[model samples]
Target: MSMTEAQTTTRKQALGSPLDRADGRLKIQGLATYAIEKSLENMAYAVVVQSTIPHGRIRSMNIERARQSPGILAVYNHHSGLIIHPAKTFGQGGAAAQAFLPLQDDKVLWNGQHIALVVAETLEQATEAAALIETEYEQQAAIVHPDNPDARPETVDALTIEWGDAVPALAQAEVQIGGVYTTPREYNSPIEPHGCIAHWQDGSLTLWEPSQWVGGARQVVSEWMAIDREKVRVISPYVGGGFGCKGGIQPHSALACVAARELKRPVKLALTRPQTFTAFGGRPRTHQQLALGASRDGTLQSIVHDSWNETALNDVHKEPCNAVTPLMYASPNFLSHHKLIHLNTVNPSWMRAPGENPSAFALEVAMDELAWALKMDPLALRLKNYAEQDPQAKIPWSSRQLREAYQQGADAFGWSKRPLEPRSLREGRQLIGWGMASGTYPVRRTPGEAQIVLYADGRLEVQSSGVDIGTGTYTILAQTAADVLLVAPESITVLLGDTLLPRAPVAGGSQLANLLTGAVHKTALALRDMLITLAVSTEKSPLWQQSPAALALADGFLWLSDKPNLRVSFSELLRLSGNDKLIAHQDTFATTASEDDRNKADSTSSMMVPPTEGGVSAHSWSAIFVEVAVDEDFGTVRVKRMVGAFDSGRIYNPKLTESQWIGGMVMGIGQALLEEGAIDDRDGRITNANLADYLVAVNADIPELTTIDVGKPDYLATVLGGKAVGELGIVGVAAAISNAVWHATGKRIRDLPITQDKLL
Candidate 1:
């Protein structure tokens, strides 16, 4: 079958069906409980006090006023001697977004640093008393931007990739395109803010919070409170949204725990709108330089990409903006390097797509410039440099259909009608243009475990510590289990985001579906095999000596495929065997890893790197086509429409997958034309800290959007034969929109947020 054709499997396949979210009713009716809503008896509200100075040391703190305020239970500051330890940073294989623990001392690292906490009987009282707590500070000069003279950048050797020399290759090439591109600092801005409720009872702590990794959060809290790991229980069944900010433990969780322990009662702390912007990390500002060399025939010969991003003074978080340059296209000589600029800012965390999102904007736009320079079609140019295998690893891909995606997307978007010349197509006051770009993201899988139980009454239960994060975890897992047992999805119940469940990894990097689906599928199969053994061994069962391969299980009945009349219900079989339930557990590893990788992960608590088979690479691919209408007078750009074709192996649920794609594309539109987290240089404070000021793509900004799924199942990638699609949808969208703007106005804007001022 052609790789371009989407799988024609029906609901019976269970993997590619467009199943509705199982938790839809509960969520729509507001019955689903969130972190802050997990109220406990006699819960006291806690409000965090932030430092006004970016860099400072507390000279003195006066909590007497707060202590005398109405309904005030207690007020604590740095001198309160809170028993908290800094968690291991996420990059170091622990749960914290930043390694720095706040409130340990008087030295303030940045503006909005948690200086104190006020506990009151009500939220309003806590907020009022928190404002009354005063503090004097001794300020120091701070460096908040990379452009500052005091800023010093350090080269990251681990992220650097060098192959054949690119400088000499570029100079001798038949054509070259070089330019600087930049993207501003952006926040996650999830619908739900980061919050937590901490309760300590019977020498055990229970935390209700929004987290992408409940297990990791439990570990962090246990380590910080000096409690046993088993004594810490984290529960987050439903999260409003968590792009990446809530993926790990934040300082607020620690503070809430401390307050609860000190006051001997449950403590609730929910970050305010402005506090959400200041308390958590976001995508750092990036400056990238890209140069591409190609032959006169539009074949890429050399590529050089160097990038720099801001980081906190103490925490070094570098953005690998050039990571996609080596993976996207085929080039004989390439150089990709990264650097980190130390500044007084919130340490950056993973946003949707993280490095790849900004990286593709620069790389793809550069490719578009090269295509224009060569007087060639953009899509044709990409085809000429298409990578048949991993250019660096020199191996075959597990499954790749990027070329087919381009072809299908182009046909649907009417790319053949796009004029070759820029600013040629016009409609009244609008200059119309169409542009396209290719996107790619690596497919990585980690270790996960699951548990499944089946009762004689035909009830199925699946449990895992993985989180939904609004990606339809409940629905997909049900489908996967139903596929194996030949049961209806409604009969299966999925429980997730609890420490009591089986172990699972963080729900980032698009790995949850790849890991959990495999776990459920394998566990369900194991249960089936166990039941088949019981039936074959018992003489009371019909066709006791029947071969397992010749029998099929469906709707809680076991029968011979060739003799349907000879059937046995699961309840009857269990009753005869004097068993009430059947249970199975499975540990899943999506990829094979070497001993060294395993040892490294074990020793450093870092993520495991799975070695490929012989030399194979796995990646999800997409082709994005966009149309934009540029106003001739106002210089404003409006996206007319967008179409994306994706090759992500077998899409587990088309409805959820398309939602993710459309959401990503909308974020991309914001990145290209609206979003920016402005900062006050003097105080290292965010100027636009609220949603009203921080522009995002609203319903009015998004035009008609369409997505196409195309690919065959890739067994080589994983047992489920599905790659990660969470990050792939947003990879090259900014570049496609930027390219469209250029095509419409003949003006190339390298900087992001192509505002009307830049165009005018």
Candidate 2:
């Protein structure tokens, strides 16, 4: 059955219910069109040739043989004079993941940099031609890792947070615990891989790509092509999965656009799996040193955290691993700073929770160690140090239920029955243990517009330029409108991920649902008001002469709240008013993009306005509990179960929220026991560039999972009351798993992916 048909058959209520995804049917039936699937007339195929050396300058290129090959249309190199301008980096409020444009110069900044693009009549021809091209490079010695002696670490002043003298406080503390933690580079291996098709016609350009930020992608292409923004259109209705890889405009996109414009024919380019590892940014390798000082009674005295993560030499994108330190706990003295280490690798981008994931691992592990030293339960230690307010921002929490989350998760996980000492619980040859950790992510919302239309035929349409990224954005939009209009969800149609729709922020930072829903809510309310006005003005309608306040809508009918007999169907009201549909548009949570606010820029024609500032700090909190079993001889560790209690503030869909949390927990399992991107130091190339070499959690790796919502409405944060939920699930997951391993073996594994070798 179709998604709408299924919902109608089941008679499911909208909003906060376990409603199936609105796009589930289309996806399963292969009817959903993703980027690169959009077929065009006379479309040509393009393939990329990458640099072999870590860093160098192209000396010579031999493209004669490839050009002579059958079906080859064109081969573009740095000398091709491809007319594409440079764009600001995503960090600088532009769409590009990195500032340095590829195939623009002879200089090679990193291994696997796109050196050339070959276009052909067919995919096979393009692939063959791309492989036939050869080049010589003048190689240079490269610093490939943060640990390299020649690598210099530059501290980011904006990331530094300091209040009191933490060093002195640590020295005078009654007890202190500290540790160094490291996480290897990680790749965002989305199932569909990144690809794009660029088509130009009638002085306008259209791009079909799996972009997490459709509006931002359009804006970037317009700036790079030096054309009017109106001349560029980005259509990305479905994305297999983004996880930050497709969050920004990558080089291949620009390459495809340039090739299409130059050749005057549509060009399609899809990166191979290995190319994905280098073509786009991934999570940077992080090195963190975290220290905590506390009193004998487990009261936190000081917190000091210093961290460095790898960034490309061509672009600076530091992984601020110290970001969560100050907000994690209340301390009399605090010091946290972040530094970027230049490496001959691709510029790193946000992966999942980005800063919060790695930072939470270090901080939570240190908290576990401190708990061991204080002879207190890890959960107890966390509860003792929980900040009632945002310690760093010096503001009250808009809404915080972390304490409730802890209590609820602990009760659900049966924490009271667990033995305190390591290796105390065993089952046959397996050593059993329990561990817990806390997680938090900031609540960020950007201004966006939503357009809603109530058709006289009793169907509703909600439109926005937002991408779902598989986070149930479609369902959220449908549910929000259905609830507001008092109509069945199946009667609503939602359009998104198109530049033709109303403007919206990029679907990143866990902000899309909150931002989009708020706009939809505002529009829905306005639409209801319009319907009421239509009914009250029509002399033939029973609702005539009634105040809007006295009118109520339910079951697709407008009626007086006091007298149910006096009612008018929406269609009847529309017909009486001689209108086919009622349309409403609203902008919500708007922000003006200053230099400081560029990260949240919205490039639509709507004059950028200031967001209503609130004094309270907003964040989503969670408490994760894990149970694990360790093999005695084989050093195999298995996560048996996990329970996560979260306070994300007004979950719009409980079913989808649970799915997001479970998926995040699975990723967390991978982070703790499997996933890592291995880079070859000699060439700065990722040794494990494909799924065969790289490891991630699969069905066999997942354990029993549970999620609890301890959220409440926080009107101060957003009118919808929902906070960010996408990245919150993975925040403390790795830490909880690592701590469970420690409890099982009494061996503290400081590094990530606690492999069997590390345990052995």
After superposition, which runs of candidate 1 have C-alpha atoms over 4 Å from their true positions?
A: 1-13, 539-547, 590-605, 610-614
For model 2, residues 1-760, the per-residue Cα lDDT tens digits are 4333433543456777678999999999999989889988899999999998899899999999899999999999999888678777766756677777877889988999999999999999989888888899999889987778999989899999999899999989999999899999888899999999999887799999898888888888887888987899999999999888888888889999988988899999999999999987789999999899999999999998899998999698867898688887899899988998988888889799989999999999999999999989999898888898889778888889999999999999999997878889899999888888999888876778899987888778999989889989999898888777777776789999998898887787788888888889889889988888888888888888889888877667888878877878888888888889888988774344453243244553222222224788888999999999999999999999999999989989999999898888888999899999988888988889999999999999987899999999877877888987988999999999999999999999989889989988
Q: TM-score of the candidate numbered 2? A: 0.95
Per-residue lDDT of model 1, residues 114-167, tens digit only: 889889999999999998877999999898878998887789988888899998
Q: What is the clash tally of candidate 2?
A: 0
Model 2 bad stretches (over 4 Å): 1-12, 539-550, 560-567, 589-600, 604-613
Give the per-residue Cα lDDT of candidate 2 at 599.
25
Query: Which consecutive 10 residues in model 2 have the weakest lDDT in total?
Result: 604-613
